[model samples]
Target: MAFDGTCVACLVHELKEQLLNGRIAKIAQPETDELLLTIKSTSGQKRLCISASASLPLIYLTDSNKPSPMTAPNFCMLLRKHISNGRIVDIYQPKLERIIHFTIEHLDELGDLCKKDLIVEIMGKHSNIIFCNENGMIIDSIKHVSAQMSSVREVLPGRDYFVPDTMEKSDPLSVSESDFIELLIKRNMTLAKSLYTSFTGVSPVAAEEICTLSGIDSYLSPKELSGDTFKHLYNQFTIYFSAVKEGRFSPAIYYDGKEPKEFSALPLTHFGGYTRKEFSSISEVLETYYASKNTITRIRQKSADLRHIVQTALDRNKKKYDLQLKQLKDTENRDKYKVYGELLHTYGYNLEPGAKKLEALNYYTNEMITIPLDHTKTPQENAQRYFDKYNKQKRTFEALSKLIQETQDDITYLESISNALDIALTEDDLAEIKEELINAGYMRRKFTKKKIKIKNKPLHYISSDGFHMYVGKNNLQNDELTFHFAVGNDWWFHAKGTPGSHVVVKTEGQELPDRTFEEAGRLAAYYSKARGSEKVEIDYIEKKHVKKPNGGKPGFVVYYTNYSLMIDSDISQIQELS
Candidate 1:
């Protein structure tokens, strides 16, 4: 998680094995702080990406290539001039620090072999890629840091290159058992903090891992630890670093449920109960972990406005719906008013002129009732006034009932769109939703300059029984998939009484296996608003039985008869097709 000195140690070990003696074939700078190097090694051609970005510094071997700028940056040109055809003599890490030094032997402009050091520092804010001569004098850097920007050290050309020791942390590889104990006992910090602060490369997570290995509480004060506890901690710490020295790295990513929590270059026994995905290389681990994280981050950024739009509309509709319900409730007295009018109409002839109130027997309830009246108006006029109130309330109830239903429909539509946004994995998926929103009049159509043809399609899956299943991503896809893509014999599934994707399993002119039907139901439930619920009720029927209403909203359908199943919304076993 820290991407600290230990990770750098692992990377250097890997680079030394894969890239040592490799000839630099080509170098390209695809971004302001990124470089892609193509190298010819004894094994094969390898592409190495190194980034000095302040936000997300990374170094990994990748098979994919990035598009370079039309004009190379000065740093890119400089590296090309110096090390274009250089041979990598050695790759090493300095004192277990978060830095990598690549020693390159190349011919200078004078046609004489010269050596240069290409240093990549992966420190958080102070990260940089620097090229220096054999004398350790900086030639140039990807990012120029001066005394003005940082009082700690300057990274300008011709400055003597050296790793900063501002933190005064001891190198873990050199710290003796006695030194480690003395250092921790003297510190007033917590156990976790003392480890990270006193030793290089020990992150908080790594510190906690040591505690777990020693069977000790990380919150306990180091000074308060007993003699046996101290010995256990030291033993565990030594064992952990011993693997790094011997290159016994077991790269893996820890997961909390389905979410990636952290990755390490060594086994994280502290995460024994959690899910662990082991990788062959740390580069593979970083690439897989970050790529998934980046996709989610990018999609969230792209769908932020859509989420806001949907949520706002949802709130408005809910308010309107509640107000309508209240108005509908107000009409409850309409029947009483009607009864009063009827009683007055029948008993009006017995009423005295100028009476303030009328006392009459309510025949319906068989009870005496007192009804207020207008003294100046005749009994007939009073009865007519009561009749008008009844009529107005009755009319209000009818209109409100219809409006309430419409408002509820709008709320449901918005929730479905929000769920679609959550399921969206690509920009194309978002485009489909945006189009749906624009068509629904919930958002103004933008005057976009670039017209990316919408090719968003339904998610296709193969059930455990080998039946092809199609799940709609949004309402538009749902309608098209059910009405056009599916055949009459195909089985359809949906989450009962909830907004969800329509799932259709192609029967292939044969009866569907029970397992296929269950998988389709699971897909329907997983893609719907009821996802993750203990048991989601799913309705399944033949495609022919699911009829779309005339002039209905997208994906709205009617079905009088359908089989139902309560099942978990787990589709991890289903095979997905691109």
Candidate 2:
């Protein structure tokens, strides 16, 4: 959520609850811009990870620890020298800004007690971890910014440390209703935009939530709102922030079918359609959300080469298929040539010598027709020449018809591979896909002394009616699930006429319920290429009715008799087995 001020406030609240009066046990610098601090509080030992990365700045408590570098960085050593064993006296956020101040009391070089401020600013690219003396003079910062870097403020030693007030936003925690309405009314923008731009900690999502709670349109400008509507919005806004002030947070991650869409420290009622998975703490929310996001991003990056290979082959086959279809169209006139030969043979004897053309009646259509003849050749020879031309085109048509089907098959197979890449979630999935490509002759097989083992498995889910449903992640797995794993009485499902996973419901010789069928259909639609469509057509039949053609590609099957269902790709209600 952009690491907005509200999130900072949430983290600060969590830190105060866990780390107040805690003694710093250990300090480690795993990355140049990151620090892992071990603290001993009343509850237990906790690890606090703080990162001032330019791209992703974060501060959260985590159970996982990272390997530290052999030599400490200058910033890490400086922090350890002064505040290594310091007691955290206080922890607070400044006026709802995206900044946290940790007051630490430690003994000076002469054994005298002194306090220092370890400030963590969660601003986007300007994020920094600064160590300051009691009087707010910067001792050193993890990141150094000179005057040339930023004209607003320089984060260097001996500089007075302060939070930049460039945005000039009001503190939502302290602002009154009159001030809120007056500030919002002055901005000529949408209500949602006005709220975030006017307040320090209000994000766009938070603003939208406030508008939703107040039954007001967030798209409307402040000028369009009546006085009573403004009062209602302000009331909702106060109620929203009061939770933060009172530490009544409900941390959750909202998901759209298994993918995390958004996270919030407070409940986001506007996103009621999403699947909400609440966490006991905001730290869990941050860890799970970012970990899932990183997995998705990493898999995508790893599959780029496979995607390119599949796409290149698909494009080539598609172009070849188009050309073959056009060539086949030209052979459509082969029958006309045959008719011309017959007409010439029937009326050739009556033609005058050196005649350029012969006019005759066609017996096939019982109509008058014209046939061109060679002036130097006899009529019989001309007829024979036409017969040869007809034979050649007939042969061409037959060859092109067979070639066109093969080209079409190649195109479909390549498209299925592309779809497989889309649904691949791990390295093993990609390895299986790469092996398929190598076997299909689209890629060269890399030789190795030892065979690599692939542990990829089909996605398993339990239907609402206590039935088991299995979804194939790739063509190999699809073939295995349908032909080998499922029994004759099992139900088979797939997206109609599209590249998708094969869903098999193990009925165990029992008649399936209607709800099980619908749930299985949803799984088929969700795992297929047409995942986001509102309604997808699914074909279902018994495993005995589904047949795989001899010498056909993997995952290719045909069923003559099957039932069809039009269902959506939403599988949020379905329970998946990990």
Best by TM-score: 1
lDDT by residue (tens digit), candidate 2, 258-371 = 789889999999999999999988888888888655446557867999889898988888888889888888888888888877777788888888999988888888888788
Candidate 1 displacement at residue 113 in angstroms: 16
Q: Residue 374 deviation, candidate 1, in Å?
A: 2.0
Q: What's the TM for model 2?
A: 0.72
| lDDT per residue as tens, model 1, 1-578 | 88878888888888988999999999999878889999999999999999887767889888888779778999999999999989999899888889899999999999999999999999876789999999999999999999999888899999999877998888887788889899899889889889989898888888888888888888889989988888889888999999888998888899887778899998778888879998888888878888865556657877999999999999999988888899899999999889889999989888989998999999999999999999999999999999999999999999998899888888887888888898888788998999999999988887868676997789999988888999999889999999999999999999999889999999999988789888998999999999999899999989999998887778788999999999999887788998
Clashes of 1: 0
Name model 2 segments beyond 4 Å from true.
Answer: 1-3, 15-182, 190-192, 208-263, 266-278, 287-298, 444-452, 532-535, 560-570
Clashes of each: 0, 0
Candidate 1 Cα misplacement greater than 4 A, ranges: 1-4, 12-59, 65-169, 187-197, 204-263, 267-280
How high is the CA lDDT of each candidate model? Answer: 0.89, 0.90
